[model samples]
Target: MIRTILLLAASAVAAIFSGCRSAESTASIPAVRPFDAERYLGTWYEIARLPHSFERDMTKVTAVYTARKDGGIDVLNAGWRNGEYRTARGRARFRGDSTVGELEVSFFGPFYGQYRIIALAPDYSSAIVTSSTCDYLWILARESTLPLETFRQYKEQAAKLGFNVAALEYPNGRPE
Candidate 1:
């Protein structure tokens, strides 16, 4: 009887831990395949994003990625807020396949967040990225501004993917 009870407790503990891990995983989101990480390296401007506490009232946001010696990617995200530029440096590494746009990024040590690219332009000019949850989404462009029509198209794509498009805010205030 004692052995059976111990086995049940162990199973329960394993189930609980697995659930917690999945909560922080982006397995539900399908990342873009055939992605070229080499071409994706460089600066990308933030066009639009769903509201988040860390990026509140920020404008002219941008992200820069570079190849790291350890085969990881170095990340630098910056935004203009309160009349000054605020920046956060992070690191990202591929979760599995390098050709797939699924990465785990960490700004805080040992606590990684999902960085999944759901859409991307063939020429690497624009992209739509999301996180483990539906709450995090971003539209990025090579230039600071994208054509108005292109922006709308990207918004529609996000909407189709079940993102809350209506809640997205333009960091530079809607492309002109």
Candidate 2:
């Protein structure tokens, strides 16, 4: 009886570990060519994102990138949470190739991670962005709200990029 109980406990532990491994494996994001800094430098309102530690429970988020005098990029991120304004400043620099839409952004300090522009609209109205590890994603738009058709198209593109499109959370408190 003791041996049987131990074996069953071991089996349960293995199952739990296997489930965790599978979840981690599916969290990866797809790769895309580097992004064009010059064209991408502008204001982007966050339409949706995968729940992330840095941005959890946040709403009314917007990011603005500007060309810097030092040949780098300046990043200003702002959001409204709990009826107050929240902001963070950061910097970004191209890693492999800027034209390919891949760059690393740093907020606290030298720590940086990939910021890939996977899908972009021809009119520059919206884009689907992803992180290097595929752990984070953001749907950005020039306007506070995206048209239904445009939103659908972006969702399709994000699905093609291996993102969990259904996991996206639309901005709360957005005007209908």
Model 1, residue 6: what's the lDDT?
24
Point out where model 1 deviates above 4 Å: 1-26
Clashing pairs in 1: none
Residue-by-residue lDDT tens digits, candidate 2, 1-176? 00111222343355467864222222244334444567778888888776654565677788898999876888888886678787877777776655666666766544565566777776678888765433456778888888878877877877776778777776654322
List runs of model 2 lying over 4 Å from the truth: 1-35, 173-176
- Give Cα distance to truth, residue 151, candidate 1, Å: 1.2
Compute the lDDT for candidate 1.
Answer: 0.78
* Per-residue accuracy of model 1 over 1-176 as CA lDDT, tens digit each: 10111222343355467865312333566999998999999999989988766677888888999999888998888888889977777788998999999887776656566688998999999999877666678899999998788888999988877788899889888764
Leading candidate by lDDT: 1
lDDT computed for candidate 2: 0.65
- Indicate the TM-score of model 1: 0.84
